[model samples]
Target: MATLAHLSDLHLGSSASAARTLEEAVAALADTELIVVTGDLTENGRTAELAAFDRITAPLADRLVVVPGNHDRCGDDVGAQLMRGVRVDVQVRGGCSIVRIDSTAPHNRVPWLSHGRMCQQVLEQVDVALGAVPDSVMTVVALHHHVVPLPAEGFWEQVSEVLHLPNHSELALGTELLKVLRSRCDLVLHGHRHVPRQFIVDGDSARPLRVFNAGSTTELGAFRTFDFAGGRLLGDPRWHQVTPEPRPSPQVWQAPVCALQLA
Candidate 1:
């Protein structure tokens, strides 16, 4: 069985850098066929910060698939440069096929900005990508925002509540997106809540549907590993946590680290 790693919301160059945890995650998941980063690579999408992220993840070069979060596009041309690793939707031979979409609006800091909007253009793209998945291959889709509210419990709930001025999730659009993917995909991976969640979303069809929120890998030290065989998920995902070491250097990233290579 082949293994896959799921991580999200590193938020680098912000309050704390989880360089150590990231390193550990790479080491721990070294054997996985692919490492899918859902979004929020940098705290503010600074060129330097993205470069640092590239350096930290370069060892996994060919095995990485990344997507953008609201923060990743904050800098100039970051979206174009960073979108390569953010490969959206594919057919993984002998493994699973994945479809990823950009769920972040250019402006998300506004009171009404946090909500995820799934417009017609985006839906059509998803429809085309997911519609072609071969039945033998497991299908997975990814996005930066949550399709469901998935409120956390207790103290975490309080923090999540305050973080949102007005909770505008991908309610309607997510539903439309799901309609296209429900039968096409088995797992839908995403992260924006910064809190890990594993649950089943029941659509009209009875086929098993799963959703995962990887949370902030750099912040909460949370991640997951999935085993697959014959292009199907084997069983329940294994969750992991790590204690990160402090950043070795206090320097920050403000300049472009590499040339733009988004294809």
Candidate 2:
């Protein structure tokens, strides 16, 4: 089985503490086959900050798969340039097909607007990418935003929406994106909210879709690994952390059996 590490929200330039935690986390993953960073690489998308990220993650450069987050797009177009004009990335490693999606919202001068969105064009691109993968391979999709609303998001986001503030918490068109993914993929991984979460999106298909959010790998000093083979996950995800204390189990949410149409 292939071992894959999932990490997110490094926020490298934010503080010295976070950077140190990131280093420790990376060290623990020395044997992981692939390290997927969902996003938030830097506190601000400055050239220096990006450089710091590159330097810190250089040891695992060959096995890294990264996508930009809202924090990574705060300043200029550097993050976009790093993406190389590719919104969807498909790669096969260790018998698993991983498709990464760029879910960050379009650039705006307002830095506090941290919500994500997937337009129709990007959704179509996801379809094309997944179609190219064979049925025999386990398919995993990674992005920077959570597609379904988590319990941790409800209270604050509802307040933001009621106040008509610009800081919306939910991903626009997320439901549509979830529907598209549940039909085509076996697993989905993401991060944005700093809380780790897991959910099962069940449909009529034989295999239900599993989704996991990695939270803030730097701040939380934690990451998760999965074992996969023959297009299926072998067992429950295992959490690794820099601290000695055991990581808390993530809250589980289950999608409706018929169809997932969450509002």
Best by TM-score: 2
Which ten contiguous residues of candidate 1 have the minimum total lDDT?
A: 253-262
Candidate 1 residue 41 Cα shift, in angstroms, is 0.6
Q: Per-residue error at 123 for model 1, in Å?
A: 1.5
Candidate lDDT scores, in order, read 0.68, 0.77
In model 2, where do residues sit more than 4 Å from their true spots? 151-159, 203-205, 244-263
Per candidate, the number of residue pairs that clash is 3, 0
Candidate 1 residue lDDT tens string, 1-263: 88788899887777544676777777777677878898888777688878878998988888887777767767653544655543345645336687878776557533234545567887887777766777778778878888766564356445656875344444457766666666567788888777576666453344457777787887666577788887667877876655543222112111112211111
Q: Write the per-residue lDDT of candidate 2 for residues 1-263, one digit (tens) a residue.
A: 77889999888788997788878877887888888899888888788888888888888888888888888888764457556788887977767788888887565224667778678988889888888987777888989888866544556666877887645655666777777777578888898887777777774457778878888887666788988877787877887778554333333222222334433
Each model's Cα RMSD: 9.5, 3.4
lDDT of 2 at 183: 57
Error of 1 at 190 (Å): 0.4
Error of 1 at 148 (Å): 1.1
